[model samples]
Target: MANKGPSFGLSRQIQDKINSKYDPELELILVEWITRQCSSDVGKPEPGKMEFQAWLKDGCVLSELINSLFPGEKPLKKTQSSSMAFKQMEKISQFLSAAEKYGVTKTDMFQTVDLWEAKDLAAVQRTLSALGSLAVTKDEGTYNGDPTWFFKKAQENKRDFTEDQMKAGKNVIGLQMGSNRGASQGGMSYGRQRQIL
Candidate 1:
């Protein structure tokens, strides 16, 4: 017997967009993460072999990814109150608008949202993540230090510690250096030190 579920694969356009926007390393991570989230099997598909259906059972995988990438953005929650529903609708509107700006259509987003309505928190998250991913483009770079990035920026600003610099004994801020006393002065003192002959 054949598999009954919808075929898994990304449209050529979406695939192209993803490839262009994300670096190869980041793409691999995304693929791996998605696979881990969606698949029941322990082994994951190769990066090149990843398909939309592989990790997108509903949209939860995408939602989790979005949450991780954009810590400031909150996913829509399932609500019973009418007022909360209104607020959720407003957030959805904003997301759809943003997605439109990035080439995704309101219809496309609505379909995903509708399919996952009244489902668990994971479903809501996945729907939002799908929308968020659609809205991202190459022009808008990712947030700094987001773990989504596979290749991180080079540490060019790192300063090497010299013998004199180490000997200077610069006090670190917010770090407790001595005994664990309740109110002991642990901060670095900026004043000059006196030496006894």
Candidate 2:
């Protein structure tokens, strides 16, 4: 007997949920990404429920894609100190909140925490990466359909002002009055009085 061709479509419920959560353009991008990442067969059709579920379970592809998008940035690392553990928990909480907004269940997120509890750093990293991927989907409509908006925003927020830069800014502000010391007619000089008519 000839082998039957692999099934090619997602279930209606899952498809509907995805559609509701993502815009059509974003959905297309996600479908293409999934097809590229999960399919081994040449000329394979779009991923079906089994393929989608398997991809979610494996998570390596999702993790790789996210890591590639954010080069030189690893947000999830093994916690060595108490402060690091606190920070990791805060990050996990944020991820859970974002994932919930994108329709991921708490139970699914708890599995990631379980990996952390087990001291499987690799697994936790992969899980956090997968969650990051899913969180991008929630940015579709609100962020002009750019999936990397959150990541970019997070990067911007992480940037800290250097002490030298802060001191330079203060110096600039302090020198403003000195710079205007000689200008009294057009530009007001410091401590100058305007006569009342």
The per-model lDDT (C-alpha) reads: 0.42, 0.42
- RMSD of each candidate? 19.5, 16.1
What lDDT is obtained when candidate 2 is compared to the true structure? 0.42
lDDT of 1 by residue, 1-197 (tens): 13345324575555455335333454455555544443443244444423333433333444343433333554434312233434444444544454455444444454333322421223333344444344243324433222443333233478799988786766444465565668866686669686779
TM-score of 2: 0.26
Residue clash pairs of candidate 2 = none
RMSD of 2: 16.1
User: Tens digit of lDDT per residue, candidate 2, span 1-197?
Assistant: 13445434575555355334323343344545444433442123344433333333333343333333332453334323233544545545544454455454555455444333332333333344354455464343222223552242232336689999888877565544556555657664769788889
**Alpha carbon lDDT of residue 178, candidate 1?**
60
Model 2 spans > 4 angstroms off: 1-28, 34-46, 75-197
